[model samples]
Target: MKTLMKRLRAFALSGIIGVGLLGSFPALAAKTTLTVGAAATDVGTLDPHYATSTSDRTLVAWIYGALVRFAPGSTDPSTIEPDLAESWQVSNDKLIWTFKLRTGVQWQAGYGEVTADDVVYSLEKSRDPKRSAFSADFAAINKVEALGPHTVRITLSRRVPNLLGLVTNYAGGFIICKKAYEERKDRFGRAPVGFGPFQTQSIVAGQAVTLIANDKYFRGVPKIKTINYRFMSNNAARDLAFAAGELDASAGLANKSWLQRTTSIPGAVVDVFYPAELTLLHINITKPPFNDIRVREALAYAISTQKIAEYRGERFTRAPKSVIPSNNLGYTDNAGVFPYDPAKAKALLAQAGYAKGLTFTMLSSQLPEYETTAQLLQGQLEESGINVQLQPVEHTSWHQMIRKDLSPVVIYGAARFPVADIFLTQFYHSSSIVGTPGAVTNFSHCNVADKQIDEARTEADPAKQVALWQEAQRLIIQNVCAIPLTETSQVWVHNKKLNWGFDLKGSMSLGPLVTEQTSFSD
Candidate 1:
C-alpha cells in the first residue's frame, strides 16, 4: 500500500510538470515585435497619396514603395535609388521618362505580382486632384502609360524642377496594388495592400496599428517579425512607457529639457535628425484688420523670431533668414523683413485704426510644440498691445479647422523636397489659395508672388529659376503675407538594443525607418 501511494504521487507530479513545460513552449514561439509609441492621437490615413500627418507618413513608408526611393536612413534627394523599378531612362528634352519594373515582386496578402499596369494606375491616382492631396506636385505629368507587363513610361507636359522628387518614395509616389485597391475602394486606406517588407495586419482605432513581416518580400523577410505602432499623444506618458519597457521606441520632444531627461534613462539613445522644418506664422490677409498690410507688419514686428527660436532651444531650432527654408535650392538671406520694434509695431497698429489694441481669437493645436509656441506668441504680441485669444483644440482637429479657414493666424511647420518652387507654390501661389478650387495649405491666401512663382516653375535656366524663386521670397516678405518664425528639426528616441538596419540619419518621413535588417540585440 505504501509503494502504491508513492507511485500515484510521482504520476501526479510528472503531469503537473508536463503542463508547466507546455505553457513555456508557447512563450518561446512568440513573435518578435517592435513596439513603438508615436506622438499622435491617431493616424489620419494610411493611403500614401493622402498621408500627410507624421504618423500616417511613417506607416506609409513601411507599407509602400515608389519607383525610386531615398536610401534607407537618408533624407537627401541625391540618395534616391531604385525601389520598384530596377532601372529608368529620360528623354533628351526631359519630357519623356521610362521605367523597367522588377519581376516576381509579390504584393501583400496574395494580391499577386506588381506590374506596369499597377504603376500606371498608382501614378494616375497621384495625378488626380480629387484622389490625391499631392496632385499639385504631379501637375506636370501629361501621361503615365504601361508599355508592357514590365515596362512603364511617363510623358511630362512641361519641364519640372525635380522630376525625380515627384517619382521618389515620398507622399504620392508610393505605389498601390491595383487589384486590391479596386476591390477595397474607400476601405483601401484602412486595409492597405503593398509589396513592402511589412503587411498591414490590423488597426485598433485610438489604440494600435499592427503589422507583420512579409515572408515573400522581395528584399528578404524582415528579421523583426512584427511592428506594434501605438499612439500616445501625451509626451510624459509615452516616455514612461519607454522607460518601463512597454515601448522599444517613441517620438521625442524637441526641446532641450525633455532631451536631457530622456538621455538620463538607462540604455536610451536619442536621435536628432536634419532638414529642419520651417515654422511660419501665417496671417490671414482676407480676414478683418489683417487685410491691411500695416496690421500684418505690426504682428511681424511685435514678435521677435530670435526670441521665439531661442525659447525652443538654440540646438533644436534656428531663426529663419528667409521665407524659404535655409537649405532649399533658392533660399536668399537678403529678403528684407521687419525689425523687432514694439514701438513701431504699435504705431503700425494705430495707423491700421487699432490704437487701443486689436483683439482676435486664434485656434491653437494642443500639440506641445504648437501650444507652447502659441503661448509665447501671445505674450510677445501683448507687448505691442496686440491681443490674441487662443482657443486650444486637438492637433488633428486643429488641422481640419484651420483648413476650413477657421483660424486667422495659422502656425504651420513643414518640410518639403529641398526646393524653392515647391514651398513657394504651395504657400504663396494664387492657384493654391485656401478655400478655393485646387487649394492646398495656403492659410494666408497669399497671391502677391504669383508672377515670380509661376515663372520659376518652368524656368529652363538653372540660375534664372533660382533668381525667380528669390524674388518671390522678397515679394512675399515685403507684403508681410506670413512671418517666417524658425526651423525645428525632428527628434526621436529608441532603445539601445534596437538596430534600425541603417545608420542613424535624416528621414524624409520625419521618423526612423525599420527595415528588413532591423532587429534587437540581446
Candidate 2:
C-alpha cells in the first residue's frame, strides 16, 4: 500500500495525459496534433534494445531520452551533446569516464526520477546478451557503477576517444526505468516508458501509434501536444495522402518519379540528404567456399558498379568509390579493391578451382532497394560465370536469418555516422560475428585488421587516429571481406510549415525530431 501510494504520487507529479480508455487515445479539441504517414508497414518495436529500423528508432526517440544525442539533423560523430548526462569527464588515462546526471527528471507512467541507478541498469542490460541485441557494443565497457544518486562512473576496456558518440542515440544509449520494465517483462517491447518529451498513448495494430506530450518534460513540453505515427506501407497511398493534406510528412525514396509528382504540390518540400547509408554484400569467410580469399576476390571482381548504377535507375545514390562514403572521415581515395573485370573474375575463379563457375543463393530483404540490388547483383555475377539464385525474405525475417549466418552471401544496408571506427567495428570486429556467441553484426566474420581498428579507436590524437582508421579500411578492402555497393539517398517530403529546427543536412531520425521548434509556420 505504501509502494502504491508512492507510485500514485509520482504519477501525479509527472503530469502524464489521462485517457478514459486503456490502449486508446483521448479526444482533445484544443491539442495540436501532427499526422505523420511513413512508408513502414508497422511500428516495429518500442523496446529501444530490439529496435533496428527507422520506424522503430523514430518511436524510441518519441518516448525515450538518450544519455547523449547527435546534434539536431546530423549523424556526425563529432556533434554528440549531452541529454540525460548533463556533463561528463574523462580520466587522464582516458579509461575512466564519469557522467553527472541532472535531477528532477521523471520517467513516463510516474516511475520516478531519471537517476544514476536507471543509467546503470540500462547499461547493464545493454551488456547482457540475454537481454539486448546490442551486447557486443556494450561489451566494450569494462565496468560501470553508480557513484551516487546522480553520478555514474564507467571504465572502458579500451580507450575509445569517441566514447560519447558510441553511447549516443542510435547505438544503444536510451536509459530506461528498471522497476517499470521488470514489472512488465512480457509486455516490455509493446509498451516502453522513458523520461522523454512524450509518452505513448496507444498502439493500434496495422494502423498507428499515438503519443501525448509530457507536460513535465525537462526541456519543456513539446509544442505539438499529440502525434499520430501512421504506418502507410503503400508508397502510392502515402503520396496520395500527402497530396490530400492528410499527412504532415511522408517517407520518400530518392527517385525521379517522386520528385516529378511532389514538386508541384503547394506547401510541400522534398529534402534530399546524403551520405545516408552504405549498401554492402558480406562475404562470410568462416563459411566454406567463400572462406578462400581468392573466391571472395573473384566475387568482388564479378561486381560491376556501372552496371549496378544503370540497373538501379533512380538517382537515389551512386556506386560507392570506396567502402566509406566520399564525405566520411578517414575515407582514403585509393583504387577500390576490385575493378569490374569479368576476365579477372573468371581467372581468379579458375585458380580457386571454381573454373566451371559456382552457384550460391544470396539472401536479400524484401524491401524494394534490397531486392532490386540483389537481382542486379545476380545478373552481374552471372556475367562472370557465377550463378546466384536470389531469395527474397521479408524484412524482419531477413535480418534474423542473415544474423544467424544462414546465407554465406548476405546483402545488407546500414548507416553509421561518418565515424569509421563504428563502421569497421560493427562489420569486421571479431567480437561482433553474427550467429556466434555474443554476436552482433560482424556478418563477414573478418578479423583482418582488428588490431589497427583497436589502435585507431584508442589513439587520443585525432590526426593519428584518422590515419589508422584509414589503414584499417584499406586492409579490410584488400581482404575482400565485403564489397562496397552504393550509398542510398534519403529524401523526406514534409509540409512546408513544419520547420525542422536545424539545417537540413541529414537526418538520423526517420523524420527529423519534432520539437517545439517544429511548428506549423502557417
lDDT of 1 at 382: 96
List candidate 1 stretches off by more than 4 Å. Answer: 1-31
Candidate of highest TM-score: 1
Query: Which residue pairs collide, candidate 1?
Result: none
lDDT of each: 0.88, 0.79
Q: What TM-score does each of the candidates earn? A: 0.93, 0.87
| RMSD per model, one decimal | 4.5, 11.3
TM-score of 2: 0.87
Worst 10 residues of 1 by lDDT: 23-32
Error of 1 at 442 (Å): 1.0
lDDT of 1 by residue, 1-522 (tens): 999999999999999999988966644532378999998888778889888777788888888888999999887878999999999999999999999999999999998899999999999998887888778888889999999999999999998888988888888889999999899999998999988898899999888999999998898989989899999988889989999989999998778788888899999999888668888999889888889999999998998988887777787788888887887899999999677999999999999899999999999988777888889999999999998999999887887788788988898888888889888888888777777766678899999999988888888999999999999999999998899887888888999989898886788888888789899887
Per-prediction backbone clash count: 0, 0
What are the clashing pairs of model 2? none
